[model samples]
Target: MRPLLVAALLVLIWTSPVTARATGSVLSGIAVEDVAWDDGTALQIHWRTKLDEDFRVLIVREGTDGLMDTLGLFPANVQWVVDDDVTPAGTYRYRLSVFDSEGILVFTAASHGLASPHANWFHRGRLGEALIILGVFAMILWGTFRRRDIYLRPIGGLSAIEEALGRAVEMGRPVLFSAGWGAQLDKPTTMAAMNIFGWLASRAASYDARLLFPTHDAVLMAAAQESARESARIEGRPDWYRPEDIYYVTGSQFGYAAALDGIMERQKPAVNLWLGTFAAESLILAETGNHIGAVQIAGTDSTIQLAFFLVTCDYTLIGEEVFAASAYLTRDSMVLGGLWAQDWLKIGVAVTVIAGLVGTLLDWDAIGGWLRGI
Candidate 1:
């Protein structure tokens, strides 16, 4: 009976209140969130340490099965470590270990999982974007079918284009067409500039007029060449596409100005059309063209440059009129649709502004407060 009691007492002693202790500081397991899988085949794991827990360092481990079996330790934070580069795109398991003020309390590590690949737009969303594009195109087609005779408000600058080319022809001199620095495919101004170039080139070919083009952008140069060649062909003068005439000037902003200045001083063109985007170079080019007795007609949407052109050139197109040139010149369906859309948008904006002012005067707070409280 005593042997039986001794064995039961030993069992109770072995099972009851088993406590394990360590001398170092105790660390709570790391807390993590907002895991991002980037395109570079990497996973980013972010975590925060326990609040008010004093620790000598932090240890992070990545494991395939999330059991710190194959462990790795992240370097100290004070070393300016970039931890993101080492993390791979797979099931990433992380464990955090630290020493606290009291003792070492190592908690179990938490794991987050994700797969990474190229970002994809949803098929439905892609379809929607396609539909929006098609809708825009359809509206343009509708505008074309229901075409109205748009009496283009006369632009003094546009009106001067022919006269400028004609003046050059009369003097047996070259007509200089600078699409301006603004005539880059990436730039909104270039579209307007190209439209003007098309018109000018056609007129030049018809009159056996010499056309000279200087471009500051490679894209603009290519476009200007195509437009000039096309215009000449349309004018039944396919042989008139002069490669040397439409040449590239330096791409540097002021470098172009200086190159053009030299050309103007040398060729002394009879007519100069500076159309497209211009910057500080606007005045410099126009002034040089002016000094050569060229009939300078400049058009730009730049408000700052308009004043300079007005002072120097024979005629200038200002602000929105410059944008309107494509619609006026091409009479293209899309361009017309854009113009119409803007017209309606402007009307809407005007009505909104007016309504806002009137509502303020009438004390709109009563309506706003009622809505807010409800």
Candidate 2:
């Protein structure tokens, strides 16, 4: 009985399929998660291998009319496979096989499941996109709560505003203000104009000096006129708000400047404030203002026109300073918060740039490579 049992055990060991030895290669922890979409056509496959071996995946479609397709080859132990330009939406099966330096030998654990290409916005954007969205909101809110006054370096151009207004009062001449082309929207440029103009117009009333406000947009012109009138009333001098002075000029760029040039020649304002965004007509207005002997103070974020303002205007606001002007003027909490946040960001940027420069000089790749990746 013991001999018969030993023979049966030997037969079971020799004949059982599970006793077969690996054919010079092996695949262990094979897995496939949910498929990911690539564009409108492709799909991404994620899997794991037990051993490191060179292998290729062959995706097969199982049905009565079956078809087999060799997907592509990838490194052994590779955990991912991306197949692009796949056929239209349908259920399909997939499998992976192991290959050697010579030819294909070992097979991977079979993956027989449905692969359907479905359309979805969440999939299009991805589940993790909430991270970016939430991060942006957090930054904005963080800026608002951590609000602090930004240490602004002195700007010669912006500082000239008071000087110009004072000069106009001393000279007994009207102050001219052109509220740029797109000053209607409450963007940085337009907001700067509102704050600066409100202050200047009030001072002009106090000095008993004339103020001329030219408008390119009806809405902005209306707002400026009302604001100036309201400011003059606040100063107990509503009569100083002249409706004709805030009259509508043509919307055409050249036409507006030409009309303004005529006014500058005749009225001869002692001070000119050019605020908001300007274009090709900037130099034309500046040159005219200069010719009329107006002490010009300009503020803009337009890099293209900065040089023009620098050459022509007595004072010019540059870049972020224009954006920070409202916060500086109003001292509002939320605006100050944003300005402080941006200032910190700017400091971070400056430090990164300085670090990169030092690292580059030392032939170090740490900072340089990290910046390149970003």
Candidate 3:
């Protein structure tokens, strides 16, 4: 009986390939890679496993001390999975393991990888965006060095500078320039206003006319004083600048408007140049200037305030025209160059947008894809 049993076991072992190895596995080619176009929070895992329906794949994630823990079970046919809960710049390891019928471990394929996802510096999906930005800036900087002429369309508000100053001079009244409620010299609107203010101060000083700046912010007042003095000096009328001319009004929004309105009613400035940012006080100031019968010239980036000024003021700088006025009035080489670069960039953007629209309508993706890839 012992001889018969031993012979039968040996025959079974010889016939079954599973006895050749203690455990057998058929999972292979497992890999991990970063997910594209994301903010570094995802990873993709890919693997090949036995295609036979008899096998199941286990997705294993790393635990502490490099221990493996089963994340989930998957069908053998699944080739890839995306893990979006991973942390950025974190290292990780994953395994694709196979199991056979009767719960026997069959095979495993591991890949030590990372959660270090990257933000696409230039969203290749946006195609020509980065290229356009770089090209525009490069052209602007080049304009600064080359001292080339940049053609710009005539802005009515910018062209009115001399006429406004002349009116102030003729009327023997001060020229009022105000950066309404949100005036912080560091802000973009205020900075642009300063550029135009320099020209205003220079022209006013040259004409022996007074320039007034009543501001709600102390910082803006200080900047305005310095700008006035510098402009006076540049225009060869150093004595024309008075520190008291740029004064700080109350910080309260409506209070500031009331104070300026009083001044407008009493002093009746010949030319009222409203620039920078404004809120509710925008209409208040414009209407007061109108009531006082002053020649009001206004520019602002604030859409709502700009609309008010357009209807109330004699001349208005619409939207980006305020920034453009800075370049046009000052004629600084760098600024002019920036304007030229910006215009060309706008043209390029318009063309691309039209092309993209046409392509989308016609069912052609090449134009859109190429721009985003750039």
Candidate 4:
């Protein structure tokens, strides 16, 4: 009877719950959401740590098999993580396990999720940006119809054009225009150049001063001739238009430069307008014009060539001033509207920057992070 009682007591000791402590819950609120703007291979995991828990949270990713693979380890304070190493279009499961400092499992919580990345037509994050763009476009159209006036700082180069042409007339010498070797009719710089040329030709014809346009491309020559002809007709001096005044030179860069240099030395043009695209040959042409005592006005989009024109030419259009030249001369509504819109945009940017700066100092992370992805 003593042996039977001892055996029964041993069995109770082995099976008793009084010796084992239950594991405390360490994680909660496990949620998974699909990631935006990505192929179907990722999901975002969000979770919360239990109050007063001091443990390492080990996030494990499980597949269809229900077997856990350790994704990452973080402090219990971490609330969110992204799991990117997922198979496309495949279902997945996640388990958030907590471990004590001694590496013993404390508690775990799990959530099941699956995401197959599909391309979305519109990114939810960019919705605000799209609205702002639409708003700006509407503003531009409204201002255009309203004939909103824009204030432009007086550009000395643009203002000096009339004076230069007048000096050419007084000297009784021809006004020379070169669009440089790279001035093709299709390029924006060259197109602007032609527009300015049309204006210049009009003034020249009205003053009865001769004008010449030398080009490296046949197409540009034809374009220049038409521009001159149209300007003459507009000024009621169709007979003043001369095809020989707008002619093609050698397409070879240096060859064209040499020919123009000879013209400068011999013709001694009173006004030299070097506008549009140029190259390394810019310095050479500009130097010759400077030596000939010609009043020079130059504009170009070339970063490297601009330095030469800036110093050598008596007046130079900096940056997009070349593009704005036509608008200033003609006052066309389309260009004026665009310029007004641009000015307003600049103001908006300045205000946004100032506001963002102030907000950042005050701990408003949202405003400052606008357009950060840029």
Candidate 5:
């Protein structure tokens, strides 16, 4: 019976697959690789196992001091682990050990070569976006040199600036302007508002209209004063520039709003130009202007305040329209070119999104895959 059993076992071993017969080592294909397109702080450890028995993997790294530090003990089912604790441009060596259910080491392996983390200069995944930006830059340069008129859609809020000033002139009332309490001159929204303010100051001087600007920041008050002075000089009405009129109000948000409301009530300005960043006070100011029967033109980058402005103001410049005001008002070739390039880029993005959706619906994975790769 023992001889027969031995013969059966030998037959089973000989006829079985090579993988089953080659169970001397439970682990195979152990490798270490540097993670790509990263800031050079990670390494990936990869391995494979054929054994189905309950086991765990112990990963260790040899430091520069030649001391082995155990990374962690992971389940056998985990095929890869990312070591983000690695330093940039540092060499590393790793060893992996396979242990059985009883914590007995079964097989051990090491990376074939030394691995070092490196920082890539450019991200390959964003290559498509880079190309699109470069194309837009080239278009801007071409448009700059061509010196052709770039057509821009008129913004009613911006177009009415002159008409608002004209109404102020007709009514013999002041044109009140504010850059809001939420921002300073350093903010882009405030700077954009300053651009519009400069142009409005010049026009106000030309129309001999009273222009009042109040601010919640001292630096912004100084900037507005400079802008008004410069505009007055440009319009050849330096006497019309009133530095006192462009004054600093309190820094408190609600206090500033209340002061503006009082000004609107007492002065009864015929036109109100509210631009820049605003928060809760947007509704307070706009509602006051509406109550006084003023022609209000408002603009802001704050989405939260935009709804209030839209409902209360006569005309509102939303989002990027406020940024485009300087270019639209001045008609500078270079600035207009930037606007054109931005529009074209938006169209391209929209088209790409539609194509990706269509490809997904048709079960054509190539288009979606290419877009994701980019």
Candidate 6:
């Protein structure tokens, strides 16, 4: 009977399924890798394990002193972690320690190979953005080489410049142009205003109308003088360019507004052209122009002052219309090509936004993820 029982036990032991024993140090497959396409400031740690909520993973990195330093404590189920506190081109190794539900040390593992981060020339994540930028530049080159008439939407404020000058000529009153209190030659709005000023100066010279430009900035005053002089020279009427007309007023914001109001009231300009940057004084100047019954044409990038210009001025160039004024008026191929590229970019952005919205609605994560450069 003892021999028969021993044989049955042996058969049962051999027939049972072979399973891995839950040894205390069971963590395996630890790996350390470089973070890809970054500035080389990070490393990635990966491992494989079957752990529950009650277990925790404690990661450590080899310090400069050759001792392990704690990286972080993580949940047991996590497969990977990013260590951003690494130096570029520096080799790193990692160790992971597992703790059981009772907070007792259970398992330990170390990465087999060293990993070092290196910077990539281009970011892999922003590939879509890079492609879009390249496409924009390509479109710009195409527009430049083609040199066709790039049609621009006509701006009412821009179109009314000649008419405003005509009214000034008819009324025998000077056409007043101001770049407002915050005017600076370095500013885009001010530069665009100067471009418009050049065109207006040329037209004013042709009509033999007096064009007055009062500036708040001395540097802007200098630029205006040069632009006015060049425009007059181009029109074969350098004598019409008055250096005194583009003079600077007080730098004080309210003081400048007061001086402008005095000029507008005393000179009684039939045409008032307000462009460039403005502050609280925008309403004051526009109101004064409206009170004097001048044909007020205004353009600004300032959102708050836009409402005042819209209400008080006869014609208002909204937002980017001011920037496009030079290209629209001059029709220069380079500028027109830039505008063309800008339009194409805008179209691309709009299409991308709509596509992302549609993709989100349909639960297609790839489209939205790509759009977000993920």
Ranking under lDDT, best-scoring first? Answer: 5, 6, 4, 3, 2, 1
TM-scores for all predictions: 0.65, 0.58, 0.70, 0.60, 0.78, 0.73
The number of the candidate with the highest TM-score is: 5
Q: Model 2, range 153-259, lDDT digits (tens) per residue?
A: 66676566667767877778888898776566567578667777787778788877888988888877887888889989999998888878888998988898899
Name the candidate, 1 or 4, with the larger lDDT value. Answer: 4
Residue lDDT tens for model 6, 37-65: 98898888888777876877777788555
**Structural RMSD, model 1:** 12.2
Rank the models by TM-score, top first. Answer: 5, 6, 3, 1, 4, 2
What do the candidate models score in CA lDDT, each in turn? 0.67, 0.70, 0.78, 0.79, 0.84, 0.82
Model 6 TM-score, all chains together: 0.73
Question: lDDT per residue, candidate 1, 1-374, as tens digits?
Answer: 74463344334433554232443333332333322334343344444443342432333445455533222333223312223433344444454443344433333234444323232333442464577567666655665565566556677777677677778888999988887765577777777777778887888889989999888887778888899899999999998888789988889989999999999999999988887778899999999998989998888877789999999999888878878887876777667767776665577568756776677789875534433454
Alpha-carbon runs more than 4 Å astray in model 6: 1-25, 65-70, 101-103, 149-154, 169-191, 201-269, 277-281, 333-369, 372-374
Residue 227 in model 3: lDDT: 87
lDDT, model 1: 0.67
In the range 290-335, model 4's lDDT, one tens digit per residue, is 9999989998888789999999999888768888788787777777
TM-score of 1: 0.65
Candidate 6 — what's its lDDT?
0.82
Output the better candidate (2/5) by lDDT: 5
Q: Could you tell me the lDDT of residue 73 within candidate 4?
A: 64
Worst 10 residues of 2 by lDDT: 56-65
In candidate 3, what are the lDDT values of residues 1-374, reduced to their tens digit? 74463344334433554422224446667888888877777778887765676666666666334654445666677778887766675667886656565445565556854435565554555556666667777877776676677778788878887888888888899999998898787788888888888888888888899888988999888888888898899889999999988999899999999999999999989999888898989999999999989999988888878789989998998878988887888788878877877777788889989989899999998888875666
Clashing pairs in 6: none
Clashing pairs in 2: 157-315, 157-316
Error of 3 at 158 (Å): 2.3
RMSD, every candidate, angstroms: 12.2, 12.5, 10.3, 11.8, 9.3, 11.5
